[model samples]
Structures are given as structure tokens and as C-alpha cells.
Target: MTANVLTIAGTDPSGGAGIQADIKAMSALGAYACSVVTAVVAQNTCGVRSFQALSPDFVADQIDAVLDDVRIDAVKIGMISNAGIAEAVADRLRHHGAGNIVLDPVMVAKSGHALLDPEAVSAVREALVPLARVITPNLPEAAVLLGREDDWTVQAMQAALPDLLALGSDYVLLKGGHLEGEHSTDLLTGPKGTRALKAPRIATTNDHGTGCTLSSAIAALLPHHDMPEAVARAKAYLHAALAESDALDVGQGHGPVHHFHALWGSGV
Candidate 1:
């Protein structure tokens, strides 16, 4: 069967992040990509200038249009900017009973712009978080979910495993890239066990779409493998993208990872 991956996210006009990155990442991994935009973000690698979120009904209509026709193998969700949209997503996906869902809790942008509304945070936690098969949250996002400060280290992430596991997700991948270190380590905890996945940190400013890429890659790989295996494979793919990222100059600020590194050849 042909694999298909569906992404629900906001638009990044610059094409370095959000729905753009999600599509690129999934398609690069040999999955047919489909998307439903929940918001339109006027942003770049530098920062988010502003954004306009679509109505919850519009978002649901898009979801229904896609789900009504295509048989999606997996779904990658990111950048739900409000509570109404979050609840809509949760309700509809449950109605369809979509499995192999990967949710990236995108609270803030790499450029320090807040992508999610504070009031909507509760809605996502209450409605969407539990429906996800895998929840991928960065340190700061995890902190926001836990109602704490954004200060996180590998130790801190490990210590917070119990709290994350309690959020009803069968698996949680706490990203450790924001921590100052020589390695980018991600802690993946699940109902089965815990794993510390480590990859050498690629030294480059081109890391704008990393979170979206990783989660989309996970979604693309999930139909073929288990959650842990899918995550590990996705990490390996992300490592290659990051390591070979220096070639693309998409913007003046933090650039995007090289999605076609294997085919185009790396500049580094």
C-alpha cells in the first residue's frame, strides 16, 4: 500500500517551518503529503511578526474534506493556535478514530514568537493531548504544559518523565536540543519503557524547522514500525538533515534543514 501522511498546522509563508516543513519532511521520506492549514503566520526565520488563525469551523471543514476521501496512514499535527481549533481537531479525529497520530506541541517559535495562545493551552491539554499517540514537546513547551519555568536540562527532562506520562499519551518525546550541550539528546518515555536518544549536535544556524521535521518524519514512519522504532528512525533522518543543513540559505536568520540532502549532495 502507498503510504500517506497528513499534516495539520499553520502556514509559514517563508516555507521554512510549519505546514511547509511538514510537507517537505514527509514527502522526502517517501510518503504522499496532505495538509490542512489552521492558521496563516506572517513570519520568517527571524521571528513571527503576526498571525491570523482560521475559524474552528473552517479548520474542521478542511479535516473532514481530507478524511472523507483519503486513507491517511499517519497524521502529524502542529501549531494549533487556539482552543476552539484544538477542541475541533480532537473531536473530529476521535470521530474518525485516526490512529498513529503524532502531535508536536508547538508553543513558541525558534525565533521566540508565541505560536499558541495562553488561554488555548488548557484546551489543548484537555482535548488534544490525550488523543495523540505520540506527543513531541520541546523543553520550553514541556515546561508550559507542566506550568513551570522554561529552564530545562537533560536531568530536568528525565525527572519530569512521570508528569509527561500522565498526560494520557502512550509515548512522549521530550526534546533536549534547547539545552546547552555538545549533543542533542531526546528523552522518549512510554508505557513500555524509557529511552535516551542521543545524536551529535550539528553546529549551524539552520535549525528553524527541526521540530516540525522530526514530528512529520515520525508520522511518516509510524505506519511501518512501532512508535519507538519510528521515533529512532526519524531521529536518524533528522540527524542527516541537520548535519547536511549548511548548504541551504533560505533566509537571513535561522535557516531550514536540507530535506534533499541525499539527492542534491551536501555543501558541507
Candidate 2:
């Protein structure tokens, strides 16, 4: 049976991140995609200019409308612009008993723009993190969540696992993409133990929406695969997309990964 994956996030008019990237990744992975907009963001491959967050009640209404009708197999939550929206998303998902929740703590964008409010950090850590089956946070985000400095080495990342897991997620995917290495490694820790998942660091300027794509892809896959398997497959998918990202001419500063790289014919 096909899985229904819902993405609760903001917009990326450039179609490289947020709701646009989530839908593309889910569809590319053969899952039905659904979405609820939490913010309308003006951003492209380069960076975010400005954004307007939706009212918390309206965000909750959107969640209710979707959960009431569709059987959401999994949910990938991205940018909740403020504390109210963060609480609203958590409340609605818990109310619906949503499964396979993948939370990507998107604190700052790749271009150095802040996507989440400072006040929302606590709400996400308290309300949303506990509900996630897997929470994917980059080094900076992990540091913020733990109220400590960013991990600069693998050993430091390993040392932070217990605290990350204590944040309430069943599993924590601590991303090490910011580190200087030939292979991008991420530590996945849970009931079994910590395991490093590595992929060749494709040196390309097209890294937009990587977090959104990976988390959403996992959400799309979780209905059929176990946590470990789903994460491995999602990382592989993102790697391939990154490897082929240069094939397209999207923007000058940064470009989006080729989400349909495997499916689309040549010369797109």
C-alpha cells in the first residue's frame, strides 16, 4: 500500500525547500504527499528575504482538516516560525496520534538567515521533540537544543548522544555536514546504539533543502521500513540528489538538489 506523508512547514517560492521540497521528495519516493503551510516565506536558492507566519489557530485548523480526512502514515515537520505555532503543531499531531513523526529542527537557513524564532526553541524541544520518532538536527541546532556549544568533531558528537536522546525523540540523527571531511557523517542514536551513516560529500553549490528532503524522505519511507533502514535509504537518496545537483541551472548563490534525478529523463 502507498503511504500518505504529510509535511508541515513554510514555503520556498524557489521550490528548493520547505513545502515544495517536501512534496517533491515524498512523491519521488512513491508516497502520497500532503502539506500544511505554517509560514509564507520569500526565499530562493540564495536566501530568505522575509516571511510572515500564519496564525497559530489557522495552522491548527489546517492540521485538523488534513488529519480528519486523510490517514497520514507519517509526518515531516519543518519550520514553525514561533512558539504558538510550535505548540499548535505538537498538540494537533498528538491529538491525531500521528505516527512516524520526523522532526527537523530548522533553526537557521544555509544562507545564514534565521528561520525559527528564539522563543520557539523551547516549545519545540519541550512539545515537539518528545513526539518525534526521529529528530534530525545539524550541529548548530543540536547545540542550541542542548544549550551548549556546537560539536566540532565526531567524538564531541558522540558525547552528546545521551542528551540528544533525552530530548524525547525515539532516535536522534545528529548531522555532521558542517564539519570539514571528505565524507559527510551523521550519527543515528536510539535503543540499539549510535551508528555512523556516511556518504561522499558531493562538492557542489546545490545544497538547498537538504534537511527538508532527508527528513521528508524518511517520513515517506517509514511506513514500510524500520527506523535504521529508512534513515539509510533517505541518506542515500539525498546523496544521489546532491551528486547530480550541478546538472541544473537554478541560481547563482546556491541551487537545489535534483530531487527527481533517478526518475527524470536526461536534459531536464
Candidate 3:
């Protein structure tokens, strides 16, 4: 049976992140991808110029349209730009009793453009975080959620995972890519314990949509009903996509990872 995955996020015209990347990642992982556009961003590989958020009612309508027909097994949420939209999405998910929600706390773009409003952070934490099966936050997003200024090392990242889990998420995956290191380390913590995922950092500026891709991949694998195993496999897939990014050229600025690297045999 085909796993059906849904992504609620903004539309990135560059196809590097947001709903575009989530859909690509889900499809590449052998899942049917469905989407709800929360915002429309005028962005490219370089940066985000401007964005217009969709109405909360419209966002809910889109989600409802999909869930009413499709047997959505998993959901990936990203780039909810405001508090109202976040609340609406949360309420709809609750009403539908959605399962296996993977949240990518996308605060800013790789080019340092703020993708989420500072005022909306609290709304996301209070309304949406609790509903998530796994909350995936990169270093900057984690720092923002925790309200810390200092850089997060691997030890600090591991230590903070529990506090994130305490926010009501069943699991937390703290991505260590933003931390300066030779190898990228992602820590997954849950009711059991911490699972450290290590992969050699590819020295390239082509990681445009990694967080979105990773979270969606996890969601795609979650319908199998194995959280830890899904996370492990998703991490491996993301690492390979990054490794195979050397040959492809999408933009003059930071490009996207090869989402189909596995099929091309360019990744391990």
C-alpha cells in the first residue's frame, strides 16, 4: 500500500524548501504527497524577498479538502508565518485527530531571511508543538525556541533535546548542522533515550531545503508505525542527498540537495 503524506507549508517558487521540498522528499521516498499552502513566498536560492500569508480559513479549507478524501497517514508542517495560521492548522489537526505529525520549526531561510514571525513562535509552541509526533529543529530554530543566545555544541544540543521533548512533542530531533563541526550530528531523543546520527559534512553551500526534506521523509516513513526506525532511515537518506549535491547546480547561491540521489546511485 502507498503511504499518503501531507505537508502544510508555504510555497517556495524556487522549489528549494517549504511545501515544494516536502512534496519532493515524500514522493522520492515512495509516498503520495499532498499539500496545503499556508503562504506564498517570493523567494529563490539567494533569499526571500517577500511573502503573503494565506487566510486561516483558507488554510483550514485546503487541509480539510485533502483529509476528507485521502487517507493521510502522516503530516509534515513547515513555515507557518503567523500566529493565526498556526492556531488554525493546529485546530484542524486536532479536529481530524491527525497522526504522525512531523514539525520542522523553520524560523529562517538559509540566507538569513525570517520565515516565521517572532510573535508567532509562542503560538506554535503552545498550539502546534504539543500535537507533533516529532519536532525537528535545527540549531537556530532550537535557540529561538529556547530563547538562548549562545551557540549549541553537540553536548548542549543533546542536553536541550529533553527540554524540547518536554514541550509535549513525543520526540525531538535537534539537527546540529548549524553548529560549526567537521561532521553533521543529529540527535533524536524520545521516551526511550537519545539516538545520535553522524554523517560527514559535505563542504557545499547547497543545503537550501534540508530541514523540510528531512522532516517530510520522516513523515513518509511514519505510516509504517515505527518512529525511531523512520527517523534513522530518514537521516541516512538526507545524508546521501547532501553527499550527492556536488554534481548538480540549481542556483548561483545556495542550491538544493539532490532529492533523488538514491535512484541515481550517487549516494550511499
TM-score of each: 0.98, 0.98, 0.96
Q: 35-78 in candidate 2: lDDT tens per residue?
A: 99999999988899999999999999999999999999999999
Residue lDDT tens for model 1, 115-154: 9999999998889889899999998899989998888777
List all candidate RMSDs to the true structure: 1.1, 0.8, 1.7
What shift in Å separates residue 156 of candidate 3 from its native position after superposition?
A: 1.3
By TM-score, rank the candidates, best first.
2, 1, 3
Overall lDDT per candidate, in order of appearance: 0.91, 0.94, 0.90
> Any runs in candidate 1 off by more than 4 Å, and if so which?
none
Which ranges of candidate 3 are over 4 A from the true structure? 265-268
Q: Residue 56 deviation, candidate 3, in Å?
A: 0.6
User: Candidate 2: where are CA atoms >4 Å away?
Assistant: none
Model 2 lDDT, residue 161, Cα: 92
Greater-TM-score candidate between 1 and 2: 2
